[model samples]
Target: MQLLAQVLVNGVLLGGLYALMALGLALVWGVLNIVNLAHGALIMLGAYVGYYLFTLLDVDPFIALPIAMVVLFCVGYLLQAGILNLIARAAMFNTLLITFGIDVVLTQLAQMLFSADYRTINPGYAGANFMLFGITLPWVRVLAFAVALLLTLAMWLFLLHTRLGRGIRATAQNLGAARLYGVSPKRIYALTFGIGAALAGGAGDLYGVVSQINPYIGATLTAKSFAIAIIGGLESPLGVVVGGIFLGIVESLTALYIGPTFVDVASFGILVLVLIFRPNGLLGSTT
Candidate 1:
């Protein structure tokens, strides 16, 4: 029973990070209609940014998160405005190809600059942990989970309450009508993409505190993000959160009961099951 409780705790913590990681991808796909194949590469960049800030400037990873987000936001904005904007009218296939190219370029650049070695942010409190009812909880994981939940809630509020948020949603629903209402589609698209990148950066910052990061991690992370996004559905932020937690718990149970090697199999298997049975997602409306 104690073992089961600990496993559940671990799964919940893992799910929080997964939700944050997939949030950016879901946002871009839902709002901008962009699949963003390079999303994981952007996440890798953010992780590096956080890692360096902590290593060189002695800034704590938590403190450096906003800085990474800002930097990635600028990068995302420029990418959309300069490159993607030119092909905005092109086919969805074209956008996918372009994003794939970007992902390749970013991966190569990361490998060249950061090398193939694994890196992690080792804060002073990294090794600390607390026990609750005989279940041990790592401080870093708890902090990361808290931050993830905070960001998710904050983003949900932003989308529902802010004027700009409504405009973005409007653009997503009806680009022509949005333009008719004086909302600049181009600017809105760039801003939405930038926001997505900012979310990815924030996730990366927290991810670095919890996991080993490397240039190659992007592809795998990207796949996981895609699965979570699909499983949760792009309809709402809450859907994505639910999906992430579900996947995390499933993976944890699989790892514990079956084997660590079966984690991906279980996760993707669930994704396949969900796609077959509920094409819209567990939280998504059937209509």
Candidate 2:
């Protein structure tokens, strides 16, 4: 029973990070209607940025997060404004293809620059942990989880209260109305894309502190992000948290009992089942 409890705690902590990881993808998909295939590649880049900041410049991983986010935000904004917007009015399939091409380019570029070596952000206190109610929580993971939740809440508040947030929601509803509201479709698109990339970068920064990262981890991260997004529903930030925690527990249990290799199988399998039964997600509506 104690072992089970420990696993559950670990899973919940991991879930927070997963939720943040998928938040960007879900936001972009839900609002911009752009299934950014390069989302994971952007995440990989963010991890590298954090890694370098910690290793080369002696910046704390936490402090380096904002830097990674800003860099990715610029990249995402430029991509949407300069390239993605060209085909914004085009077919959905085209957007997917273009994003995939971008992913390939980014992946190749990262491999060229950083090589395929796995890197981790080993902070001074990375290995520190404390026991709580018979379960151990690592400081790094606890901090990451708190930050993830804070970011999600901030996103929700921004969407519900801010001017630009309303503009994003309006654009998602109707491009014509969005334009009528004095919101430039081009600028809004860029801003939305930038926000998404920023979230992805934040996730990557947390991820590097917890695990090994390489140039090729993008595909897997992308797949995980999709699963979490679908499970959480695209309409609400809280839904992402629910979905991420759910998957984290599921993956943790599966890794322990069903063999580690089956973790992916479990996540994907549950995703398929959820799609068939609850197409809108556990916490989301069909609309």
Candidate 3:
């Protein structure tokens, strides 16, 4: 029972992290209607950025997050404005092809620059942990979890209370009406995509602290994010959190009982179930 409790705790922490990871993908898909196949590549780039900052410049991983985010934001913005804008109104299938191409290009570029070596960001307290109600908690995981929730709340607030946030929601719902209100669909698209990239980068920064990073990890991360996004529903930020935590707990239990090999199988299986029964998602509307 104690072991089960520990696994549950671990799963919740992991779920928070996953929530942040999927948030970017959800944001872009929800607001910009861009599937962003290159999302994971951007995350890989962010992990690399954080890794370098921690090792080369002695910047704290937490502190380096913003830098990585800004860099990816620029990359996302340029991709959207300079390239994606050309096909913004094109078929969703076309967007997928373009994004897939971008993913391939970014993956190759990262491999060329960083090599395929698996690297970890080992901080001074990489192995530090504390006991809580008989469940051991790592400082890094706790901090990452907190940061994830904070960012999620900030994202929700941004969309609810800010001018640009309103503009983004407006554009998402009705591009034509948004333009009538002086919203530049092109600029909004670029900015929305940039924000999504920034979130992915932030997640990558936190991710590097917990796991091994390689150029190839993007594909798996992208798949995981996709599953989480769909399961949670793109209707609200809270849905991402719920989905992430749900998957996290499920994965944690699966790993404990069935072995880690079947974790992905379990996750994707649930995703398929959700799609069949709840096509709109756990929180998405039937309409």
Candidate 4:
């Protein structure tokens, strides 16, 4: 019973961060209709940014998160406006090829600068933990989880309430009509990508606090993010949250029972099942 309880608690904590990691990908896919293969590369950039902030400026990883987000946001914005927009009206394959090219460039750049090093942000309180009814909760994971939930909620509110958010939604629904209403597709695309990159940056900051990172971790992170995004349903930002939490718990349980190596297999296997059976996603509307 104690072991089961601990596993559940750990799963939940991990799920929150997973949700954060997937939120950006889902938002961009849902709104901008662009499946950015370089999404994980952006997350990698965020980790490197946080790592350097800690090493050079002595800024806490948490405090450095916004800085990373802002920087990535600008990169994403420029990439969209200058490069991606050229192919905005092109086929999905064209967008995929462009993003894949971006991923290669980012990955090579990271390798050239940061080298292949496995680094983790070990804050003073990194190892600190507390007991809650026989379950141990690590402080870093708790903070990461809190930040994830807050970001998710903020994204939800922004989409439902803000004018820019409405413009984004309008463009997603009907690019032609959106243009009639004075929402430029190019501009909206840039803003959406910027927001997506910012979310990935924030997730990277949290991830660096808890996990080991290197220049190459982005590809795997991107795969996991996609799995969570699909499982959660791209219908709404809230769906990604649901998907992340569900995946977190599933992976945690699988690790404990089957073995750690099988976790990815289980995750992707379920993703396949979800895609085949419930194309809209578990929490997504069927309509």
Candidate 5:
């Protein structure tokens, strides 16, 4: 029972981070109707940015998060405006092809620049942990969880309250109508993509603090993010949160009961089951 309790806590923390990771992919797909294959590369770039900021500039990883987000936001904005915008109305196949190409380019570029070495951000208290309800909680993971939840809340509020947020939502629902109401489809699309990338940047920063990262990690991260988004349902951001937490807990349980090596199998297995039974997603309405 004690071990199970500990695993649950750990799973919750892991799920929080996973939620943030999938939120970006969900946001872009929900808003722009574009499944960005390059999202994981963007995440990889963000991790490197945080890594360098901490290692070279002596900046803290949490503090470096916003900087990384800003950088990726610019990258995302540019990609949407300069490249993706050209095929905004193109077929899904074209979008997939173009984004896949971007993913390849970004992955190769990261490999060339940073090599394939695995790196982690070790703050002063990397090994610090505390006991709560007889459960151990690592400080960094706790902090990362807090940040993830806060960011997710901020995103939820932005979508429900802000004017620009409304504009982005409107564009997602109907581009022609959004344009008629003074919302520029191109601009909103770019902004939405940028926001999504920024979220990925934040997640990457948090991820580096908790685990090792490499250029190739992007592919797996992207796949997981995609699974989370699909399982969470793109109907709302909260769905992504539920999906993330669910996967996290499942992975944690699998790692404990089965074996660490079977974690991926469990994660994907859950996804397959979800697809077979609940095609609309956990949070999605059947109607």
Candidate 6:
């Protein structure tokens, strides 16, 4: 029973980070209607940014997070404004192809610059842990989870209370209506994408502190993010948190009982079930 409780705790913590990882992808998809295949690549870049900041400049990963976000925001803004805007009127398939191409290019660039070596951001206290109610909790994971939840809440607040947030929601609902309200769709779209990338960068920063990262990890991360986004429902930020926690718990249980190898099978199996039964997501409604 103690073991089970510990596992559950671990799963919940893992879920927090998972939710952060998927938030950006969900945001971009929900707002821009652009299924950015390069979303994961952007995440990889952020991880590298955090990694280098920690290793080269001796900056804390937590402190380096905003720096990574700012850099990725610029990258995202440029990509959306300079390239994606030109193809805004293109078909969904074309957009997908273009984004996929961007993903490939980013992956190659990452491989060339960082190599295929697995790297992790190891702070002085990374290995420290504290016992709580018979369960051991690592400081790094705890901090990562806290940051993740904080960012998720911050994003939710941003979407609900801010002027730009309303503009983003309006644009998602109807581009024409948003335009009439003096909301420039082009600027909003770019800003939305930039915010998405910034969120990805933040997630990646935390991820590097807790996991091994390499260029090739992007594809797998992208798949997991998509699964979480769909399962949680893109209707609201809370949905992603729910989905991430659900997946994290499922994966943890599967690893403990069925074997570690079947974790993906269990996760993806649940995703398939959710897709069939609740196409709108567990927390989302069909519009």
Q: Total clashing residue pairs per candidate? A: 0, 0, 0, 0, 0, 0
lDDT of each: 0.91, 0.93, 0.93, 0.90, 0.92, 0.92
**Model 5: runs farther than 4 Å from truth?**
none
lDDT of 4: 0.90
Candidate 2 at 119: error in angstroms?
0.5
For model 3, the superposed segments whose C-alpha errors exceed 4 Å read none
TM-score of 5: 0.98
Q: Which tens-of-lDDT digit does each residue in 30-146 have in candidate 6?
A: 888888889889889999999999999999999999999999999999999998988774788988999899999999999999999999999999999999998999999999999
- Reference-based TM-score of each model: 0.98, 0.98, 0.98, 0.98, 0.98, 0.98
Give one digit per residue, the lDDT tens place, for model 5 in 72-162. Answer: 9999999999999999978889999999999999999999999999999998989999999899999999999999999999999999899
lDDT of 1 at 263: 98
Model 1 has an lDDT value of 0.91
Candidate 4: segments with Cα more than 4 A from true spot: none
Please report, as a residue range, the 10-residue window in candidate 1 with the lowest summed lDDT: 83-92
Angstrom error of the Cα, residue 184, model 3: value is 0.3
Candidate 5 RMSD to the correct structure: 0.8
State in Å the error of residue 44, model 3.
Answer: 0.7
Score residue 103 of candidate 5 by CA lDDT.
94
Question: What does the lDDT read for residue 65 in candidate 2?
Answer: 92
